[model samples]
Target chain A: MQHKQTVIDIRNLSYSYVNEETSNRVSVLHDVSFSVSECEFVSIVGPSGCGKSTILKLIAKLLDNNHRNIGIDRSKMSFVFQDFALFPWLNVRENIGFGLKMKSLDKKSLDIVVNEKILEVGLSGSEHKYPHELSGGMKQRVGIARALAMSPSILLMDEPFSSLDMLTAEKLRIDLLNIWTKYKMTVVMVTHLIDEAVEMSDRVIVFGPRPTIVKKVCEISLPRPRDKRSKEYFDLCDLISKEIL
Target chain B: MSRIILGFHLTKKRKHIFTTSFVLISIAVIFSYIIIISGDNAGQLINSLMLSLFRLVSAYAISLVVATIVAIFISNSRFGDMMIPIFDLLQNIPSFALIPLFIYWFGYTNIMTIIFAATSILWPILFYVLHSLKTVRRELDDAAKIFGAVGIKRVLYFLMPVAFPSLVTGSIVGFSIGWEAIIGVEIIGLASGIGQFLNTPVGNNNNQILGISALLIIVFLINRLIWMPLLRKSQLYAA
Candidate 1:
């Protein structure tokens, strides 16, 4: 809401997978522009095949740029990949401590922060097992911990928990809200689950089909520890649902 | 507790390995006994086996070093593109066919023989490493970049572990190929290895070099019995 504190400013941001001359080109995002405030927890939801993932990839700098030029202020950016891309070689502690270790964390503080995140993500007592050893939910929890440990200026997650069962996803959604509240870390997550965006996001931005555009942005003023069963919450969910389905 | 005793998959005791090797030695001793009863030619077969083992070890070691260094060079520079097709061409040239040319150049020396053997074997290791570097998954690279792994350490951390399975795989193939190779180098070129010793009387009036041919079979047996198992277990770990 405050222009002065804006962390991201995207103007005339357009992307197409094919060259301009090609009539067959699919323009994924057209004239897409938006500003994210500092520590903003923004969720982008779209229909199944929309380019919501592509927007996250663009934010994370993983997208291949054929011609569209992307411009963003030079602040640290990190992504928690869609499928929990934990280094299979490392165990939980090493994986959580990875970004910190990369930036060269001092040994004592690294151990403390790593231990804290392990406990934070509810992944306690499993630091020695590699990613291959962990369950799917546990692996995603490891992914969340690793991203949080980086202490990045912003976080971009592409469908981070879509693969998990409903119960685990619901639990993680609560944990995600808690982490966002505590850290005030800016986050942009992609999800097809309607209630997920409504329950956790300050603002939910929906992407459109094929030639993707920001179809909608709904501001949420719901109270903390959101009640999904509440009439207002379900209303917001249903309203957002029709846009996708 | 029972699993602790023998480990995950130990069907036999440590004593079994010693006993097996002992039985093998006993079989060799019995044959030597027959040789001694028949006399002289039996002695040549024993000498030939020892010589072949030494030559194979020396050639393999040299080949491994050459391959690793060449692979490292290809991985880091523009020369990599050219080296691949060159190596492919070389892979077609049989190790034995090179012997006559090697003798003309390096001239009837062990150096010429070892070089010929090494040229035949180096391709697999070089190609394996080079291809591994080229084929690392994009997500893994992204993971590494996020971790701030850059430069040589990046390759060491991300690339090497991913490449390790291929590296070990290629080395095993190369080692197997090198075994059959030493015989060609030894017999065709000049000097002393089991192949030369076998070639000796097989070419002459005496039929005892036929006995020396037993050395080739012994080498084959040793490769399968000793080296192949070790390589297989290591490959399992690498995989």
Candidate 2:
């Protein structure tokens, strides 16, 4: 996948939040350089609060103008937050269509896309239900639907599956991989789970400590639908562990 | 003991049907006496009912509008922090203390009375709405942001519905306060209205207060009879 046309181009990006009423600065990321090729699936693993979320926030452009030191080109990016972040007031149908509505996609096409997605995600019957009426898994499904509906070229996710139980997380990882293959969209996800990155992603990048930098980028050569109990699975996890702790 | 149980059952069954055997008999006795020594009976009845409804609608409409705007501002902005101190200072000033100022400003017009009543009562409603909007889930806000809402306009579309129950509760409390204020304000300065009509019977020999009491009953009954069911239905989907 060398020189495969990178969708994201990070160049010595560093970020720090201001200390209010003072000149002090809190550094989150530093000299963080990485890129994803078209249709590549990459996962970022880091210790908690090590600027993993800050990277996604920058990509979403939900950062302050003063935080430009933590540089990002927020446009041309779509983010999936750690919390499911579903609008409780909106029904599943409206929530899924919300992004397309914002970007002003044509009404007729938007409806068609929303309908197609509702069925594709196995959420066809519960279209009219609000967020509170759904289970945690269902809420996350809606979140995924919302992000994918944007059809963004680069998708950024921040620990999207941290809330679910082991079984649900395992199943969603497979579903996510299938979705990734189908859409051929570049994805960069953050997680603390090494097994998840090994099972779902094509490449793994690790970030650590304040003033975070990319520690390693290991290519995952596993075949599709990779099972965790297999020998290769344990080896990849071990390799990631060695780099992490 | 059996008779007491029977009367309790009657009271329960006739909640709005007005069975109350003893009260109805007392009313009948008063009416018989009124007929024997009456002065313009029908005129007073009509006047009291009309005044109450007029004042109630006017004061409530004003309170609803003002309370909603204030609530939105308080909940959606950092300025909302100032609300508590402002309200506490205003509450301590006493509800009727501003009556003289109102009369001087508006010169005994209907608007004067409505304004006075609304000012005295809108705080509870505004606070309720602010509280409701503030308590909406953080996740809902993040969802709204991901959809590209950047500023004040987002509160209208994303936040208003999420705080529906609190809006209703706050509005109702405000309306009730407005209703009470209207009667008192009218009693003090206004020459026409239900409060004036009720006062006339107090000064004379008639059961005119019954009509005014009936109007009060209607306010509470109407709220439960009309809005409660709607609220319950909306809550089903909101959750």
Candidate 3:
């Protein structure tokens, strides 16, 4: 395998929240560390409240990191939120072009990029629809397209498909993989589903329960469009499930 | 099935439009009748109504701007955290109680009337916007930051839209309170306005009835023409 340049690096990253009622520091991520290479698909799998999402937030700098040893160019990053986060007031095209608009891009260029993303995400006919009008699957597609419109080098997904129905999630997982292949950007996803982690990632990093640390980093070397029914696929899922549990 | 539903919606919309037009025409007829019957006093009444309308509008505009700025400030900083309780206390003080203090400062002036009304109007808008901003979904806030919505861009593209529906609701509430404040101030101190017109001792009960009827008509029109449309549009902001 060719060595890809490292795009994200975290060493001894820890975070705590001050409990509003108690005013006591409640630790979330304790000495958690991981790294991702350029063009790699990585998933962090763990039990509920294991700080998997916190790690993603730390990378995106959405939450204050307090100068932790986290390395990633935030300007080159885009996040796909769990709840889609499509601005309710913005139509599909406007939502996708939100990042570009924030950058003060010219209208001509903005329209071009937005139009292209709309097509790329299979939302070609729904450009004028609002978020409330979109189905959960379609909304997430808009979410993904919105992130892609930024032309990001790294994509961070915080349970991007967790809110979708089973069929929608399955279809989106494949669509996401296709988009990922096309873009060739680094992806770091946090998901609780072991099968999803195994099905999509080049590597899966499992975390322990709250105040989390990296429990294991299992490399998935299975070929493209890995057979989900195959024993090997189940074994890998089983392996990750064991590590997280 | 879709076409049937669409047809039903269209029929309902037409019925609504018809009803609105009928009400508007009725009000117009009533206004014309009032003007004809109250001949000499008609001009004075119209002028007073216009003046009161202007005062209410000015106060509303000022309140909207101030409330938005204050709400954003309170929602965004630690200073805002401390100020919220103080603002809550201030809002609780009956706005009418502050009229004497306002009169002492500005003394029966238009400025005093507008300012007094603005104080009454500001609280609902400020609290509504502040609550909306404070309660924004965590993921949406993250998405905004992650996608380069910071500084003024964040406020414009993210926060403002997030606060928009609540802002409309607040404005509607604020405008109603403002009407009371403006009228109360006018009736108590000001020399001219609809409130003064209404309060003026008249030759007959007809003039007083006309004044009250005109006020009601204007309020109804404003609600239908402005606030109702805005309230409908604001629903798009809901997630």
Candidate DockQ values, in order, are 0.38, 0.34, 0.83
Question: How would you order the candidates by lDDT, starting with the best?
Answer: 3, 2, 1
Q: Is candidate 2 or candidate 3 better by lDDT?
A: 3
In model 3, the runs with Cα more than 4 Å from the true position are: B1-16, B202-205
Query: What is the per-residue lDDT of model 3 for residues A21-48, given as tens digits with 9 covering 90 to 100?
Result: 9999999999988889999999999999
Residue B156 of model 1: what lDDT?
64
Per-residue C-alpha lDDT of model 1 across residues B94-212, encoded as one tens digit per residue: 66766778788998776776677777667787788778776766666777776676676665666666666666677768766776677767765647766666565445534343444
How far off is residue B7 in model 3, in Å? 5.5
Per-residue error for A235 in candidate 2, Å, reads 2.1
On residues A1-245, what C-alpha lDDT tens digit does candidate 2 reach at each position?
46677667677788888878896888888888887787899999987789887777666666653444433344556667677887666789988998887777899999998988787676888999988889877878888888888777778888999998888877777787888888888898989999889988999998877779898888999888787799999998998898888
lDDT, candidate 2, at B23:
48
Give residue B1's error in model 1 in angstroms: 9.8
Across residues A182-216, which tens digit of lDDT does each residue of candidate 1 receive? 88878888888888888888899977786777888
| Residue A46 error, candidate 2, Å | 1.3
lDDT of each: 0.74, 0.75, 0.91
Alpha-carbon runs more than 4 Å astray in model 1:
A1-4, A18-26, A66-75, A104-109, B1-90, B127-136, B202-239
The fraction of reference interface contacts (C-alpha pairs within 8 A across chains A and B) present in each candidate is: 0.42, 0.47, 0.89
In model 1, residue pairs whose N, Cα or C atoms come closer than 3 Å (at least 3 residues apart or on different chains), thus clashing, are none
